[model samples]
Target: MEKTVSAHHACVRTAFENTVPAAPPTSDDIWQTPPPAPAAGMLDVCGRERRLVTRTRERHTAVRQLPDSGSTLENVCRTLQLDRSTVRRFARATSIDELLVKATNRSTILGRYKPHLHQRWNEGCHTSAQLHQEIVALGFTGSLQTVRRYLRPFKAATVAPPARRPAPRPRRIVRWIMTDPGNLTADDAADLKEVRTSCPELDAVTHHVRDFAAMMLDLRGDQLPAWMERVLADDLPSLHSLINGLSRDIDAVTAGLSTPWSSGQVEGQVTRTKLLKRQGFGRANLDFLRKRVLLTP
Candidate 1:
């Protein structure tokens, strides 16, 4: 009886052990909680990590801001700590037509028929589609009909009537002359005077130009000596600054006094640049023109 009872107890123990399977892993199973995954970072094309605190657009990222004191393109570029390429791009793109094309590109089509388009498209009979078809014949896979539709918007976008692109715009023709007060005609000067008077800084700049133009046009060699002596003796800061800037250019400035040549050679080069630019018909870039000019020389 004792043996049978002992055997029954051993069987019960074995049944209990068999009823329970091994438990799954709990907190004790892990060696350490894996460090939280590194916060997501931007990756470059090469798969290198680049962490930017905050993303900003390239175009909106200004090197510096101007006080809007009516500076020239060249001055604005320098003051703003910007590259000339960017400044020229911005300056030449003031017009809606110029700005619009960049926004919508039909430029690739226009390149082929450039100088001719200035004559033909300027005359107004040819449609953009017609032009596109012509280009298609030359192997452009782009939609031919879309050309006219693209160009149609430009007609309305021009700054002045019949394709006169004003500031920050590149029209089919008209080139930008300097915006300096010295560059203006008498009528334009008077108008700009009114404009300058409303802005004190601009007024100061205009007055400066007026003085410089007077000195350049009125003062003869003998007269210049007296005027320059007065400026030097007076210790005028503005005059000093002007002289300092122009001192390096003394040869160019005084060349007319000595020889029959003024900046006519330089002016001729500039005219050639403008003509070469006209070949680009407002589309040619400085590098392209430079290549042609440098290569020609």
Candidate 2:
């Protein structure tokens, strides 16, 4: 019987995940659920690589403290309250330095004029104001603060360009994907738009997610097969697995989408029964526990 059941019901990673309440979800409930959080692994726009490095170091340290950490990615994810993707990324990393490389290795607009900045600094132009003015005259449109921060790291370097890697861009991709567009911050909207424009694959994902959201909002379960077909047609391997999951119990999923029936009461009873069973450990026999659970008001 267990083998006959749909894995979608048991698997943490499935085609779609919802956190509906005990009752059938209303339109509001759909929106009120915790929005999908995207890659929860970006450093703030602070000027310190150390800040990001420290965070990556902490995650790596936590991973080491667990037994056979690679095989226990889910356990680590729960302990850290991190996204599964983030946790998987940590588990796959060869070392802290490797993870830090991804966190640190990024390009920025300020990259193009490094040579001029280095030349001026080496020629005794130590003042950021002068450097900023010079670079601005050379068509640099970035703020004077960019120049100052770039030069600040130089204070500790030995005349070479500081090994200071740029911080990864602030990614609310997952959050934006999971959240209603109406609820996004202006900055978040702009960032999401930019990300979609930059990566066609991510843009496709955004479109698919919004499509799924529409299906849910309108209870369009009949559209489920069509949606799966669309996903299958796409080049996204990640979503293909989800389509496979849905196919396992397409009829049930379709019914669920078309109707409001839910097993809330039965699920509640099961939860209560489990609670009672745990409480009765070493104190009551199975017969007594069963009677207590079934007879309790």
Candidate 3:
């Protein structure tokens, strides 16, 4: 019994000694130090270096194709827009195939956390700000912008299509729908028909807009009162306000629509004045701007 108890105690002591906690890794041990430079004949090149190599190969081909002449080096330098020494070096290269090589981006600190990020993305944690916070807790030492750039493609791919099509701007849609039916394409007419069917309020507004446009184009001031009454009966707040303003100036509105004479010349002068003002911006005073507008033929 004494022998068995002694052996058990010895085993326990051995186990305890074997399980002693290891020292934590130092900062230097955690980070991998980069080599001074890539070794010669490495396949991986940066984008700029790869472009240079391609351009060099093309120039070399051009140089080799030229007929042998007294000034071959000078001719290559002038024609190919390359330096004398560069052309000579390319001439010596035995094979252009060796220039084509693979390009690899240098690894960043965030590389270690890429697997975790992808796993989180697959698990539905799509917000980069939130992911950045979570990875920071897991010992990531990269910026939020870096995380955002890396996840852009994944987010774009995962976005859901909108449930309903967005409506065009109110004025633009109104103009297109109210214009002469012959002026609109079949597709536009179909779209307008769809919109009118979906929204009864918009359908009412479309009818009012068409009536107003026809009255303006045909000079039918006699129909203005009935049009105003019909529009007032509708639920269009925007058109209601416009008709109310016209009601306050009914005589002027009716006369302008009925009479052949228009304020078009006055409007043209105003437009020309504004244009001249813009052209002489910063340098012209009000007097100079006025002179340019009035004096110019």
Candidate 4:
């Protein structure tokens, strides 16, 4: 009986040892193993570097095609709008292919933190500003622009489809409605038609706007009174207010519309003066600004 009990205890000990997990490697052990090199696809050239490479190759090809003259390098540089050093570098190269090989892409400031960015993106942190702040805490010294560019593709992939009945923005809708019907595309026209169906008042307003635009374009001031009456009769509070304001200066408005003589040139000068004032604000005094404006052709 004693031998049987010892055998059972030995079996239980063996089973428990096998079931228990081994201790994970310590930080010291992890530090001993060097990380594997990143794949080629993991690194990318920025837009400026890519452009530089492309320009170099193009210049090299152009240089090769030109005749071997003393002024050839100068002419190539002038034609390509490249610097003398850039042209000489390409000229010294053995071949166009050599120029390509010489174009090396420098690593970006955020290159080291790309893996962390991917991990955070996959875990659903999509806000670039938030990611920028988080990475800053993790010793990343790159600008928010760099982080934003890196996360563009990931953000695009994770974007939810727009809502079925997205509310129209007032300014955009007004711009669309105010644009000439001829200028609007078929899609825009169809969209406007849909919106009109949703709100009959908008449709009424659109017709009135078109009519008023036509009268102004044709200089038919005779039709202004009738148009104003029609607008006042409508329930469009905004148009009614506009008509009331116009009524205050109806004679001037009528004369300006009917006659070709206008303050357009004077208004243009006024706009220019205002722009000059803003440009020189706090930089130059009003007297200096006046002299500059008066002296300007």
What are the per-model C-alpha RMSD values against the true structure? 34.4, 15.2, 32.9, 31.6
Per-residue lDDT of model 2, residues 202-252, tens digit only: 566778888888888888998988888887886776688788888999998
**Model 1 TM-score?**
0.25
lDDT of 1 by residue, 180-271 (tens): 44456564454344334433433443344444546656534334444445455542344556667656776565554334446678999998
- Alpha-carbon lDDT of model 3: 0.59
**Candidate 3 residues 120-172, lDDT tens each?**
77778898999888777766688999888867756555542111112322333
Against the reference, the lDDT scores of all candidates come to 0.41, 0.61, 0.59, 0.60
C-alpha lDDT (0 to 100) for residue 124 of candidate 1: 69
Candidate 3 structure, TM-score to reference:
0.41
Question: Which candidate ranks first by TM-score, i.e. highest?
Answer: 2
Q: What residue pairs clash in candidate 1, if any at all?
A: 93-168, 94-168, 94-169, 95-168, 95-169, 128-148, 129-148
Taking the tens digit of each residue's C-alpha lDDT, what string does model 4 give over 1-297? Answer: 111112122222223223322232234433574321121111132313356566666677777666365557778778778798877876766545334433422234564455556666767788899988876775667899988886775544654221112222333346667899999977567656755655566666778889988998899998999999988887776677788889999999888778778788999999998888888866989789989799977
lDDT at position 214, candidate 4: 92
Q: State how far residue 95 of model 2 sits from its true place (Å).
A: 16
Candidate achieving the largest lDDT: 2
lDDT (C-alpha) at residue 293 in model 3: 86
Candidate closer to the true structure by TM-score (higher is better), 1 or 3 = 3
Error of 4 at 219 (Å): 0.5
Clashes of 3: 0
TM-score against native, each model: 0.25, 0.48, 0.41, 0.42
Ranking by lDDT: 2, 4, 3, 1
